[model samples]
Target chain A: MDSTNGSQTLEAQAKAFFDSAPPLQNTHQITQKLDHFIQHSSANGEARRIVCVTSGGTTAPLEQRCVRYVDNFSSGHRGATSTEYFLKAGYAVIFLYRRGSFQPFCRSLPDDPLVECFEPIDELNIQVREAYSEAVKRAIVDHHAAVAGGLLLKLPFNTVFEYLQMLQLIATSMRCLGPCAMFYLAAAVSDFYVPWKDMVEHKIQSGSHILDVQLVQVPKMLSILRKDWAPLAFCVSFKLETDSNILLNKAAAALEKYKMHAVVANELTTRKEHVVFVTSGDNIIVQRDKSHSGNDLENPLIELLSERHAAYIKDSNRQV
Target chain B: MDSTNGSQTLEAQAKAFFDSAPPLQNTHQITQKLDHFIQHSSANGEARRIVCVTSGGTTAPLEQRCVRYVDNFSSGHRGATSTEYFLKAGYAVIFLYRRGSFQPFCRSLPDDPLVECFEPIDELNIQVREAYSEAVKRAIVDHHAAVAGGLLLKLPFNTVFEYLQMLQLIATSMRCLGPCAMFYLAAAVSDFYVPWKDMVEHKIQSGSHILDVQLVQVPKMLSILRKDWAPLAFCVSFKLETDSNILLNKAAAALEKYKMHAVVANELTTRKEHVVFVTSGDNIIVQRDKSHSGNDLENPLIELLSERHAAYIKDSNRQV
Candidate 1:
């Protein structure tokens, strides 16, 4: 295809995607929550920095009435943990997450989190187990405080369609914050999806032992977000790779391509312990502090990003 | 292809699958747990009837390194609920569930499950919220009793490969239980998978704008379970359909083809409220009692199945 034709076709495809896609089920409710939260956070003349942390993996359904889907690998651990850090750093957080992935604060609980962490002391009462009581209490109290103060808003998504649509709504809603708004996208988004019009409405029967599935590229929306949907917002995206050799290079390329403020490059195996921050001109490696056992890489990572975000906001204000 | 050739090829494929598939990571540990639990349960010349409740959905990885996967839709509510009922009915349960799906006692917890159900009373204490204390206590006490008494063996699986291998191990381990053992196949298993030999290694790069994926049918193992793995055990499979018209017919066909003792057929939308149990001689419709708001369909379903299992054991003894 010629360049002009390809560009027009891509633009048309993107438009069709948004037009034909099913509207998010809780759009009205989420819009109300976002409006109220933004107003509340900005009210005191000391506008709280607002950050949207997108977590977990988005699924690309194989059928309209989907029984099967292709999912990216993410437990949402990085996002959830980063959210906690962001909140602790005094930023208002919009936690856009997968419906059933890990949640902040409950990460330290047992595998059978809710049930195993509590015990019946008697017929009249249940109490948190002694071993888990301290951690559980701290998490609950801090989380409660954040929610009550209108500093945290939780929005959940399952499919790639829902995630993308909700993200657009979130971005536009935060536009009023300008450079004070931040997008920390750690969610493993699908790069390709089967269009709704092309998908079958029923469950694919097992009668055919072989199945052929065709998926078209999901139009890259990063450029659009940067150019249109909350253009002045500070954005940080992630690049996860299995190979360490290509990790930093790919992340740097993404930084240049998307004009991202920063890109966090992580290898699959060492992601929990280390990450390389790729900015316009520098690559800085950050590691979990071995001297302190409980210190997470996200603690340092968020601290650095928040500082950079603050500077970005100051610079933008001066420019304006 | 001739029928004979097709059958032979199918047999060869099944054999190759088992031979080439990765071994379960915790095979030795799981085997030891099962052996010890079985011995303890049968210690006093009275053997506890064992039920293996497989919960949640198994995911089929699209690549060898598996950054992406095809996932079956299941929250494991059926399996988790059924496990509790089986436990209450005085049966030992092997809860082989997906890693992150619902657990037996945590079902009643709020959407953000653990963190929402408790509050920090003080610096030193955490208490379950008054509104949820009673239910929480009951769940905890019952779960604790099951684990402490060696009546529950919880094993977790994630990928399709891991799930099948673990299921095989569980079935073979339960062979000694003979007619007293039961298989409750509640897990939503994927019908098709990209075989490991054919799958690409590492993440499927996003460079390919359009992606084509080919998946081969997972060899049906229900027949193998019936014929070899646990010949005398009673088995019940599930058929979850979105269409009401085909649900019962598909369930019945599964029962006949797999030589399953029963098949539970459910429609997606009404699954929480209703299920039809298809057996050799009856199609019994079971519904949640609307009058009793808290009554789960599993309570009656388990009662019926356990009674049938008891009869089967008696008949087996008579035959022996």
Candidate 2:
């Protein structure tokens, strides 16, 4: 197909995906929150650099009522950790995360922190346990400062429908920021889905010994985000593969096809230790500082991205 | 097929399922915990009534690496709430739950209670926010007492593999309790699963526009549990359906086929409001007290179950 036809086909597919999706239950509330947060961040004659960090995994429901779903694998550590680093780097962050995934500033806490980390001093009061006191105090203080200062906005999603729809909403809203906006796409979005219209209204019965399910590929939304949603925004996408051999090649292909500013590639097993940045320039490999016990891979990754974002902003200004 | 032949086939299928499955990562640790908990609960010349309450939903992994999986829908509220009620009824609980699902005592707290419900008083300490103080204190005190008093032993699982394996271990461990043991199987387990041997090792590549997955029926373990694992234990299974028309019939059939003492029939829409206890004697519908806003349906349900269990113990002793 010709380039024009290809673009039109993608546009149509994107439109159909959105049109068929069940409308988000809290669109008005979410939009209002985003508007207020963004407006506040941009107030007082300062245009704070704002980035939307997408995290966790999105589900593909086989049934409309959703008794069962296909879920992508993501603990949401990358996005949550990156959000904290971004905030520390002086950027206002909008964290679009999976509903039950990890949250920024709560990384050090236990899984059941409420029950595991607290003890009742009396009938009317509760105190953090001694072991968790430091971690809990830091988490609450840092998280409070971010939210109270209007530097962080957290919105949660569960399914592919909610994730994509919210992404479009966020991208369009961030378009007003011109070159100041960034998209950190880290969520493990579903590759295939049973479209809403094709889904069964009730839970699929288990009477059949052999259950055959047909899932259609989820339409590629990265291209649409780059071309239409927020063309001027700096977008960073991720490629996670269990096989190390095909990682960089797949990431490079994605970067070229989607026009992402950078594609972060890492083998699933080694993702926590290192990542390769596939960009227009040399492929930069960043690793955790083995010498430092407390160092995180995201710490260096965010520093490099922030530098590139600054350089991109300067170049955009020169062009203007 | 003859009953003996059918039973042999089921036993074979169960064996095959377990043989082909990957071993649980923390088998030794889990087994040790269960052994210790059960031994302690039976100590001091007074055997405590013990209930193994299985909660939450188990995942059916589509790939061996598990980048994608099928998940059953359960917020685990029923099991968690039932655990609390069971503890109140003087039953030691072995709560086998999905890893990240709701916990017994932390239900009233916010989803991200660590960051949302607490505030740092200084660099050294943190306190529960006033709005959450009462809830936090009550939850901590109750949960702490139950756990510290050796009445609640919590173990977590993620996959159907882990859940079934853990259930078997718990059942065999509790067999010594005889009529004092109860199995409250409330978890929404997967009806079908991709066998581990048949699953692909890596993340399923999304190169094709269409993905076809064939899932095999998960062998029924309820029958085995009643007949072999813990023959003297009272088992109460659950039936949840979106179609209320077939709920009672299905629950009755399950109770008969699995030889369950009772089967709880719940329609998805009104599960929290009411549930029908499909027992051999009579089916009784129990509802939350509408007059009392603070009342939970599990309160009356557990009370009724406790009374029936007491009667069952008395009958067993008479037979002995």
Candidate 3:
């Protein structure tokens, strides 16, 4: 029974191996890695679409010495939780997430040095409990990753300089992905840090001290997106407002500033509700929703994003 | 005869008591602290200037996943070792350094943290140095320093965000003092860290995997001197370059970029012989001499800095 059955099994294995494509290596590896590049295969729709997603918050130090700091309230939960929906809807996602924070939200995320905060002090001190939790989450995510239709890239940084650098670098890399779609879900960047001058030691007497920081403006790297990246690629950015009355205006200003196609504006309020305003040169509109709790109203979010973005995507059409 | 001698001794005691004054509880404390500040003052033609210095480096963790991280490149050799020259010049220096790495340096210079890095990590890994080197440096910099020139406040952080935040926050506190001078000789402000997006995870992953970092741009916080802190405050920035060729141009750009009145541009190679170009507007040009063996040269460098900068003092009419 063993020999006869084994012969049949061997024949099946041989047939499967030969029928499958050749083993990937050299140029073939590129084809293998990018095979997912065609996921939005809607035949009746006729136009293919892609989406970009950003996740995280922005913050600054509290003390003038900057040994201590504060972060805007963004758990990164909404962004990660929403990504699965974007993927299930058949859109490729360029997930730009903070280094370790995004680890649990999405496993099978690619490896990158930018996400690795090389702080030696934090290296030895990371509690085993956390490491265990991350490991377990990674295992679970990897278990399900084979069927997921998108990619996650982790980028980490202490100060804002590194953050902007990676953004510029990614804008260039996105060119290879074809005319794409973007989702700006990451929290806004921090406002300030020790001024570069004071990053050097400035003297003060031990007592009765008064410290002063002279802040310089950071160049808006986001300006490059509308000016370059998503002209052919669909782009989305975010506007977060903790202050009242400023949310929509600021979001609109941000759209004009980035010249973006759409923006997902959020508030610091307790409600899980969000008012998404899709913007362009001649068009603008707002959509409000309160479907706070569920497997995620992702299907709705995706439908809105894709439908609203259709004209822009079709207009740009395969920029590469 | 005994009564007469006792009377004279009593008179001397009264004089000493009157000069001591009261310990600083508030602004009045500045009067008491001024002597210590004045005594430590770096003397020039006249003791008209006070220089505030922050030495050492700041480090922070990437993700809050209980895995703290840090980044610090200062050896204390530059800030601590070179400070002696400034001290010998008789400038009253307010030196703020880190908890662990700068202890030996602190033993020689002055100033300690009012608060410390007190995170509940495994080993007090000292976010940069697990536990509080706190009031220890505080205890030493000035045991009597309950109050001093410019309100001396101290705080700590696990990430560069905290470090930078502290610097950003407290930096301007000194403006309340309205002091005439300040010096920045510290090193090791990491050019980068965990991206704001990844600020969540406990730890970024490991292994020789390829991870793409979508770097975001951080603002140049140091470029402050050009505006909120100019003229009233003479400012100098730094430049780090890997190659040669129009190196001075690079330094000039920094000066123009940060609006710093001056820039101490040096290459990694300048660590030893200490070659540098000190730029302050188009009017000032002092090329550093690349000659010296260890401590012998420290005195000369101070002289160069003092003499050139002395022109800015109230006593001198020179615009530099």
Note the DockQ of each predicted structure. Answer: 0.58, 0.62, 0.02
Better of 1 and 2 by TM-score: 2
lDDT of 3 by residue, B1-320 (tens): 11133434434433332233222133334333544444443233444444445555655444443223334445445555445555556454544555434432233322212111222233222222334344233323332231232323222233344444444333453343333565553545544344544465422322112222222222344544334433355555556554445557777766765566567665555554554645654433333344532344445656666665566554434443
* Predictions in order: chain A TM-score: 0.95, 0.96, 0.61
| True-vs-predicted CA distance for residue A215, candidate 2, Å | 0.9
Span of 10 residues, lowest total lDDT, candidate 2 chain A: A1-10
In order, the Cα lDDT scores of the candidates are: 0.86, 0.91, 0.44
In model 3, where do residues sit more than 4 Å from their true spots? A1-50, A58-73, A102-139, A142-150, A176-178, A183-185, A193-198, A201-208, A280-293, A297-299, A318-320, B1-320
Where model 1 places Cα greater than 4 Å from the true spot, the runs are A1-10, A122-124, B1-10, B122-124
Which scores higher on DockQ, 1 or 3? 1
lDDT of each residue in A1-320, candidate 3, tens digit only: 12233434534533332233122223343333334343333233543444546666543332333333333334466566556666655555555554323432332222211112111223122222333334333333432352342343334443444445445445554555455445454544644333333343222111111223323233344554555544455677766554546667766776765566677666556224445554754333333344453434344655677676665555656442
Candidate 2 structure quality by residue, lDDT tens digits, A1-320: 12244887878777778888999888888888988888999985868899999999999998898889999889999999999999999999999999889999888788898888887786556667889877777888888889998999999999999999999999888988999999999999999888789888888987777889999888889999999999999999999999888899999989988899999998988899999989978799999999988699999999999999999999998999
DockQ for candidate 2: 0.62
Angstrom error at residue B252, model 2: 1.0
